[model samples]
Target chain A: MKKRAQEVERALDVLLPLPEGPEKRLIEAMRYAVLGGGKRLRGFLVMEVASLFSVAPACAARVAASVEMLHAYSLVHDDLPAMDDDDLRRGQPSCHKAFDEATAILAGDALLTRAFEVLVDVDTHSDSQARCELVAALGAASGARGMVGGQMIDMLSEGQDLSGAEVTRLQALKTGRLIQYSAEAGAILGRAPSHQRHLIAAFGRDLGAAFQIADDILDTEGTAEEIGKTAGKDEAAGKATMVSIMGLEQARAHASMLAEQAANYLSSFGEKAANLVALTDFVVSRRS
Target chain B: MKKRAQEVERALDVLLPLPEGPEKRLIEAMRYAVLGGGKRLRGFLVMEVASLFSVAPACAARVAASVEMLHAYSLVHDDLPAMDDDDLRRGQPSCHKAFDEATAILAGDALLTRAFEVLVDVDTHSDSQARCELVAALGAASGARGMVGGQMIDMLSEGQDLSGAEVTRLQALKTGRLIQYSAEAGAILGRAPSHQRHLIAAFGRDLGAAFQIADDILDTEGTAEEIGKTAGKDEAAGKATMVSIMGLEQARAHASMLAEQAANYLSSFGEKAANLVALTDFVVSRRS
Candidate 1:
């Protein structure tokens, strides 16, 4: 994960350099939000899933980078004062806090557009069909039917009681779809068989669900020092989450079961799936 | 123009229906921002340019709708309190005013993502290569290097003195590139020859410049009722523009000259370019 994160960082640095103009702040905010970032778990998923098919590292890296860009754009917008109003992200000032709201908004917009630009570029894949497929999947994962829809629900549901099923659907769209795309993208890149692609996508779906449950768990149980950003936010906001509906112990148990199921979904590949299996375990175990 | 605008409105209505769920707000804001207004100049450019090559109207309409989606997203963001802070758009409340700020932001984000989604879909073009090319072109025109970059400059240069050349470069990136893409998209859809594509793109470049200049003139001379939004905003914001840099008379002359130059770029196409030629004239003459 560390190595893959570094590779993604380098790729982003190359992909988004500071232009020699006043608009340099846009690139700066984009880099600030994207680089020196999160666990790069999404990028790791793409690379590991692709590695199962021995997909070219460079090709996988670009795909990984594109997902990371999309993820970062989401984070930027999620932190906006009008959104979650976050001031810190990954223990640093959020993009809006680091560079004013307008620049952050534009930076997020640019990064989102850049993600598709990177995906469609010939450098990412030689086949235009593969490129278009990636573009289509990312759109499906991130647009209104997916992440954006999930976010809208998250906002509207605040302080409102939500059942476990509703929250599950919310989390599934909000973050799971992107995570699923991240995991399944490598198969598309490698032209893995449809059965293999479905297996990988299923693993991603379970893992992503577990990942969100873990996040809720951390938000409920961890401190700011451990989790970064403000902890206890979900509860304070009366946000409905796995932890809120299922309780901590049940959520923890559910996450453990999901992690195991996620790993089992990858079992078809046998030993080649070791890294992914471990990553699944890591998702539930993560503190931040 | 009215006919083309109506087609775009219908296309958007079909493209962005209010889904049953909490996300309906996001779609509401998207529809409210996109439908029922605007000159549809970009869509007109697209259809007219495509018509020159005898491209199918359905295919061209989709491309036009995609470009308009992008334009609407930009307008939504630009009206944010953190950005331009305008309360009015197209004679109606801005997205943030009509819907709360968070919904507006997500709506804009969704629209931007939707633009690429629309372009990459197979319905837009049977050839994956053509769809990918459209995706790439839209990204190039609207991402950090284009509209977003221009917006960044606009924000940074606010309240600061900017030369005429700097303002031109800013406008070119901000609006010119998308207009260029709007004109060039039909070529991509029809797989026009390289020389032909360049000709259309150049015409778009000149027309886009003239279009921005017309916007500045409208801001300077028209009333809010006449222009459908707050007029004289440029001078009020102390925003640097062609009109500010070149004076009203010179700016008008420059725009007139550009309309001619833009039309001349299509001279090779002769009678086939009649719609495009008239559209350039309409761009400069439109009040809203």
Candidate 2:
């Protein structure tokens, strides 16, 4: 437990608010939005995979922190009216809700920009090759081609019925790509090869698919009291989620199957990626 | 010139308009914002510096492209309502004006994220030291403590009273840091040491201050027809510009003084950084 917490504390440092200045109040707000709480799960995945490579905790921690910054930026933007229109995030006031619309927009903009800033700053990345690759992976995941793209589709298909494949594609881009990058980043630092990259990709994709399904189930079945946030958003939004298209039981079964597949993929790493192994299980086990 | 244009075009093929999916549309737009029309002077600065270090055009291009992305993103966000609220940029419809506000916002966010992504993906930057340093420099420039912070001060100070020193502080944070990073990043790629980095810093700072002071002058004296976008905004908004507070004649003199100081700093580069040397005069001389 102590070890787990020490790792978490290190991760938190990456999440800590940036130095203060009189001019950038909105940036200050953005830092506040990121610094506020949630699972910090994405950072954990980065660190966990790095540990598997025996790459030292600090190196992984930097990448992990970088990923967290990306995630926070997405959340801040997602909560805006053009996207989810969410008034709250992480059980607290959303960035836009807490700040004005323009401030929120600028804050989110700055946060996304700052995420890259944090990444390029870390002493661990070495040369441009290592730094650039990590930046590419994260950028692709976050941009319209990935998470933002997924979001665009989600918005357009709000009331339309999407196929199972469509649902998976959306989830894969929106959710899975980042996860893929998280694990793959560890592999990059670990100096894993093309074949290993394939395995990690499969694991991340399956895990992301399962994770999305589980989220669908949770939103449909979990209560706000238990989940600490609103649920049933998929149905209300008329969104075509795995549960919406496949039915809740089938979605649950699919999630289970995917989680199993994810675990199996990690077998190649032996025990090096044990926590990553555990995380697959943890992803599907969440109530919220 | 032919060779340089070819290189820029080839890189654009690899980089621009990011193909056609909706998820990638914003990425494409962001790419477009940075790609067409202008002389690509900033990109030129990066590649030229890299060449001096014996780095390939390919490696240098990546760094150049990344900074351009940063510049483009800032421009897009700056054009938004809460900031400059301009309807045109680069003599065309602004990103927000051309696209919708929401899409423009996401595009800026994506580009900012992509700059780091470009840095992270550089296959050649295996030397983690250089990559890490580059990333750190970028992060500092983009974050609230740097460019965004400066912008915030610029925004808040609008229509308010301010002393000359206060204006200098704002210009340094808002403008100087990015230019400083551009020079610093190239020096870093060249594996430059402290003295060289310091020299570039001095050059960038002096040049940036002059460039902004010129902008203040343009905002007063230049027409919308001449500048390609809204002019006289500083005066209209009662912005705490160098010209508004100190008068245009004095600001012009200061700009010249700054340009001279910036040119003096170029002496340390030993004639190797000739393009950067010319670029200072170019930035200060710009009518637009």
Candidate 3:
């Protein structure tokens, strides 16, 4: 896991070079928001799943980096004063707190734009069709009907009495879709059969649900130092989360069940998906 | 011009249909930001230039609508309190004003994401390569080194001394790149020869420069109602502009000269380029 994280970090460094210009600060902030942080779980999924189909390491790495860029952009915007107002991220100050709100906003926009730019580059994939598919999938995963839409629901659901199913759907859209996309991207890049692609996508969906529950658990129980962000934020803000709807013990049990189901989907790949299967356990059980 | 604008408006309405969901407000904000208003100058360029190559009207309109979506996203973000802090856009309350800050941010993000989504769709072009090219070009024009980078420079350069050349470069990156991409997109959609594409690109570059100067002049001379946005905002914010560096008369003459140079680049197409050539004059001379 650490090795994959380091690989994506190196890829990101090359993809986002700082230039000498008046707008250099904008690039700097983008770099600041993206580099040297996070578990790189989503990136790991891309590379590992791509490896199953023997996709080129460099190509997989580029897609992984692009996913990371998109994820970073979401975090930057979500941390804004008008959004979650987060002050910390990945054990450091959030983008807006480190720079300023305007720079943070522009940096997020640029990062999102740059993510698509990277995907469509010849270096990412020689086949333009595959590249176009990646762009389309990524856009659907991150756009209004996907991640941003999930975020809007999240903001609006604050202090509202949401049912368990509603909370699950919100989490699925907010975080599950991108994680699912990261896994499915490997299949798209590798040109896997539709059946195999569906298998990986299913795994991603269950794993994403499990991961979000684990995150909520961490928010409720872990210290800020351990979680690398402000703890108890959801509870304080009265946000509708699985933990809020399902109670702590029930949420933990639900996450475990989802993780197990997620692992079961990878059985079709047999030994080729061993790492991915193991990741399901790590996702739900990790302390941070 | 009015007809092309109406065509794009219809295309946008179809592209951004309101969905019945908890996130409907998010889509509503997106529709509000994009559906009505603006000159649709960028969209018109796409359709007009595509018409020169006899591309299908439906395909041209789709591309044009995508460009308008991208343009609207930029405006939405620019009007944020942390950014330009404008309360009006296209003579209506800005996204943040009509909605709220968080919703506005997400709406801008969704619009930008949807723009790429539309480009990658098969409806935009039957050729996957062309779709990929559009994604790459639009990304390059709107990313950190382009539009967002220009916004950063604009924010940082307030009250600072800037030379004519510096201001010109800033405007080129901020607004010119996207406009240039819009014009170039028509050739891309038509699969025009490399030489023809270069010719149109040159025309776009000159025209974009002229358009910015003309816009600055309007800010100086036009009323808020006429411009559909706050008048004299550049000067009020101590922003560096061509009009600030060059005297008003010199700036007007410079815009006219650039417009003429722009029209000259289209001479290679002979009478087929008549509308585009006429557009140069309308761009520079329009009251708003």
Q: Supply every candidate's count of residue pairs whose N, Cα or C atoms clash at under 3 angstroms.
A: 0, 27, 0
Could you say which candidate leads in lDDT? Answer: 3
Per-residue C-alpha lDDT of model 2 across residues B146-201, encoded as one tens digit per residue? 77778777877777898999989888888778877876777788887778678777
lDDT of 3 at B79: 99
Give fnat (model 3).
Answer: 0.93
TM-score of chain A of each: 0.98, 0.92, 0.98
Worst 10 residues of 3 chain B by lDDT: B120-129
lDDT per residue (tens digit) for residues B221-281 in model 3: 9999999999999999998888888889999999999999999999889998898999999
Choose 1 or 2, whichever is better by DockQ: 1
- Candidate 1 on A172-238: residue-level lDDT in tens? 9999999999999988888899999999999999999999999999999999888878899999998
Q: Lowest summed lDDT over 10 consecutive residues: which window, candidate 1 chain A? A: A121-130
Worst window of 10 by summed lDDT in candidate 2 chain A: A1-10
Which of the numbered candidates is closest to the native, going by highest DockQ? 3
| Candidate 1 lDDT by residue in tens digits, B1-288 | 778777777787878878888888889889988884888888888888888888888878888999999999999999999999999999999999999999999999999999999888736445888999999999999999999999999988888999999999999999899999999998888789999999999999999999999999999999999898889888888889999999999999999999899999999999988888998898888877
Clash pairs, candidate 3, are none
